[model samples]
Target: MRYSREHKLETHARIVKKASVRLREKGAHGIGVADLMKDAGLTHGGFYAHFDSREALVIEAFAHAMDRSTERWRKLAEQTPPQKRLASIVNSYLTPVHRDDPGHGCAVPTLGAEIARESPKTRKAFAAKLEQMIDMLAEQIPDVPRKAARKQAMAILSTMMGALVMARIAGSSDFSDDILGAGREAVLGRATSPKAGKPRARKAAPSAPH
Candidate 1:
């Protein structure tokens, strides 16, 4: 049956998004075209109708995942004070919760090593999205020179990604949360954890008349 262009476009997007999440959880080469198609509720033969090649799907999906990650961080940063923007991003990203959920968290820590080994076209796509991320991060650091801000953004991302990788590797181990905490502290100069935070103090009582 012939599907309308709109239907086709929606299906294509669905496939790409499914591929993005699965690939983040399972790595680029971890899943196959047939399985990815299956997860998208399409047959293996139907895959060719949407994408030219599995690598094409990989490129699109990786870009999709990176775009979502960037959008999330941008929204989060915008909601905070200008000076606290970077720290807000760091605290949110370098958390044990993010560390524990590869499928839903940032793509870099899960897919970076695999991306390095992908074809030039795939690598190019990855680099393009990465530039967007760096730009977003740089925008959050208003106090530095643009060049230095870019560099700092790179440093913070590298530290966060590395920490995420290490934390996942040590998942469920004693130091998994520590790894996340250290990463947050390294990026923000202090750490905050949803787990370790104290309850808000009650309002102070009015002073008695002297």
Candidate 2:
């Protein structure tokens, strides 16, 4: 049966949405095309009608997951005060709820390492979404130049991602919660510090000693 163009687009989006969740729950190579199609309520043979290859689907799914992540952050930024938006994002991202639910959480910490081994096209797609996330983060950062905000965003993302990954690896909920708390404190501390983004002045050597 021939589906309408709008229906086909909806089906394609459904497939990508399902793939996005599965790809985060299971790494890039962990789930198969058949399983993803099955979960999306379609047959394996129908996969090609929407995507050229499994890799293509994976790339689209990664982008979709990141889109959801950034959209949530954008909303958080809107509701939060300018001074507290960054910390609000960090707290929301590092919670035990997010830590326990890889299928529904941000794709970066879940799939980043696995995607690094994917093809150039896949890597390129991932990199593009990552940059969008960084830009969203940069916007929440207060009182810094754009260039410095970008750098601070990078640090904030790195800390959150690394801490989340470690928390998942530690195999205990208590430990996981501790990791999240520590990570939140560290990132927010740096971001809210009085001298954040400023260079330290070098001490002058004593002329008499020379």
- How displaced is residue 48 in candidate 2, in Å? 0.9
Q: Write model 2 residue lDDT over 36-136, tens digit each, in one string.
A: 99999999999999998988899999999999999988887898789988877887777656767789988999999888898999999999999999998
Error of 1 at 29 (Å): 1.1
Error of 2 at 9 (Å): 0.4
TM-score per model over all chains? 0.91, 0.89
RMSD of 2: 11.5
Give one clash count per candidate, in the order shown.
0, 0
Per-model root-mean-square deviation over C-alphas: 7.4, 11.5
Worst lDDT run of 10 residues, candidate 2, spans 201-210
- Which structure among the candidates has the greatest TM-score? 1
